[model samples]
Target: MRAGTLIATDSGNTLAAVRRCEGSLERMRGLLWRPALVPGQGLLIAPCNSVHTIGMRYAIDVVFLDRDGRVLKVCPALKPLRMAMARGARQVIELAAGEASRLGLLPKRVVRWQETLTA
Candidate 1:
């Protein structure tokens, strides 16, 4: 996964270091066979409306975002084997449990992601 920062455009706050995971293979392999994300780490899956924790070992905070990057919904502390979905969502951000609460991610909050250059 390529790394990046999620920033709240309104408050200018850096939400976390969220890795970008695109393509079918990457999206399908999300959080599976992966270690638990640190407090300030997350995964951003684009063109995703729903997610499942079928093989995930740790809980996660799921944030659904619209095309314009406005938050549409949040499912916090989603445990393993659970599933989450949001209508009208164009992307989803999976964060460490409680990380969304820590960042105060709410509906309508505009969050922008900036990719970090990797050598």
Candidate 2:
């Protein structure tokens, strides 16, 4: 599989694509998963209730959101092999380590994903 962007409301929040594993709740149990995306990369709507782990890659910022897409937690530069947990997270967005700070994604911030038309 190829890597893809994790886009959000803000502009130029794209991150590098590494790898993504979706629809593997059973297989991802207890294992650290990181939503890998390069800086300034954009990602579409992603499901919550999933744990993302960043392995072998550099640090990244993590944003946990509720069903309404409200920012719950923003973990900046989360080290590799480190895990960020969000119990009520309806969706978790992974951004470049410092991109969160650059984009000013703070708590209670509202985020919306811009849909892309695919041919």
Name the candidate that leads on TM-score: 1
For residues 1-119, write the lDDT of model 1, one tens digit per residue.
77899999998988899999968899989889999999999999998999999888889999999999999999999999999999999999999999998998999899999999878
Counted clashes in each candidate structure: 0, 22
Model 2 ranges with Cα > 4 A deviation: 1-36, 42-45, 49-54
Per-model TM values vs. the true structure? 0.95, 0.64
Error of 1 at 108 (Å): 0.9
What does candidate 2 score in Cα RMSD to the true structure? 5.1
In TM-score terms, candidate 1 sits at 0.95
lDDT of 2 by residue, 87-108 (tens): 7877766666787777767888
Candidate 2 positional error at 33, Å:
11
Which prediction has the highest lDDT against the true structure? 1
